[model samples]
Target: MSVRLGRIGYLNVLPIYHPLETGILPMDCEVTSGPPAELNKLMDADKLDVSSCSSVEYARHADKYYLIPDIAIGSRGPVQSVLLLSRRPVEELDGRTILVSAQTHTSAALLRVLQAKLWNIKTVFTTGSATDVLGTGERPQAILCIGDEALNLRYHPDYPHRIDLGEAWRELTGLPFIFGVWIASRESWRQNREKVEEAARLLLAGKNWGTDNIGDVCVMASEESCLNYDEMCSYFDGLVYDLGPEEQEGMRAFYKSLVETGIIDEAPELVFLP
Candidate 1:
């Protein structure tokens, strides 16, 4: 059987799928690159067998998705790529307007969790990229920017106020934030468990190589992101490439928040391999 493994085309995600670059996926399986949001839809539509998807996507389609453990895009603290940039102080954010990135469900859900549990106030939540959103409002109170945009926003001198959502989640939950996970459609996996396991094993091997050569990964990432090597490495440091106990807790907590807010009807538990 043929498998189309969809993935993100970003430096941070490169290491996890480095095996693809090195031709490590089984010959019958093909790897393609796209944002997590797109991959999630593809998986839901049953157009792909396995893909790295946003945890929120799994929650959205609980019946079809199953998590692939020991591999993920997660963060312990201060993940530079997922941030909430505020025009004002975070504590004074009540009844203020905020723009959220339309590309990521995970980032959008995190904003709801923060508003519900910490801020104790909710206002208008709109959708757009950081630039488009910032341009739309007279002055947006805050804007949620994820991926490379968040990293770029950190360097801007004017937007001095910002909060790293990953760090904030850790502070709130004492657990690492799971940003992304590999998931397979249940129907696809039921027919091809052995192939899926083989692909996962290759991914594990690639992750090991990435951890061992972080310096080179950082260098390559710098070029792709246009950040200095050191800046890129610092962003990379906060990254936890595997899903462990802490990340699972964080992921579950996030899903619980969605359930509480009525964003999703129920929490999706992680589906693991024996």
Candidate 2:
């Protein structure tokens, strides 16, 4: 049987999956793209055998999944696509309303963690368009935007407090934040482990090639994200594209915090691929 792979169609992620898109992988896998959180829901419902999932989803379903390595959408600092645009500095947001995009739970929760843990900010989220946060006489003090929305909004010159939340996470933890990871369902791993591993190898090689030829990758990403060449390059370079010890630490910390705050149902154990 062919595998169904759910991929993220974001600019920061596009380069990493170019090879797969070009049909380089050996396995007979179909790639369907969507928001990370949405993909997680599909994976849970068994609509996908493997997906590039929000790392938080892996934590939420730790008992039944394992992370495949070599390719990931991670950032060492300042992922321009995941941002918190505010009128005031992060440390000063208290009792303020923050606009949140309805799409991504991980990005929203990242902002919350920064507010509650690092900035000591007391904030509430109002679900709405990111543009609405630009203060039409009365706007939220800050706005949380992720994925394509964040990429689109970053071009505006008006956001005086445009802060990269991924950069902030690095400052707070000295580690790379793994925004997403590739996961294989337990049953699929047991059934088609060799093909899955081969596909992973191709995915990694493709990303490595993309990185080496960053100029082409940048152009492609720019077109994909509707960003100018410079903006696309900046955001693309911010991502780390691999699973390292530091990124794992950041993922674990985020999971632990979510569990402690009762956001996650339970603290699920980590499972690594062989």
Output the number of the TM-score-best candidate.
1
Evaluated at residue 5, the lDDT of candidate 2 is: 80
TM-score to native of every candidate shown: 0.91, 0.88
C-alpha lDDT of candidate 2 relative to the true structure = 0.77
After superposition of all CA atoms, the RMSD between model 1 and the true structure is 2.2
Q: Please report, as a residue range, the 10-residue window in candidate 2 with the lowest summed lDDT.
A: 131-140
Candidate 2 per-residue lDDT, tens place, 86-146, comes to: 7778777788788887767788777777776778777888887676646465556777888
Where in model 1 is the C-alpha error above 4 Å?
Answer: 24-28, 132-139
lDDT of 1: 0.78
Off by over 4 Å in 2: 24-27, 131-139, 155-158, 223-226
lDDT of 2 at 108: 78
CA shift at 163, candidate 2, in angstroms?
Answer: 1.7
> Per-residue alpha-carbon lDDT of model 1 for 1-274, expressed as tens digits?
6677787766678776665576654345687777677777788888888788888998888778777778889799888888887767887778877777777888788878877887676867888777665465455667788887777776555567888888888888888888888877777778888887776676777788788888888887787676899988887888998888878888888888888888899997788753
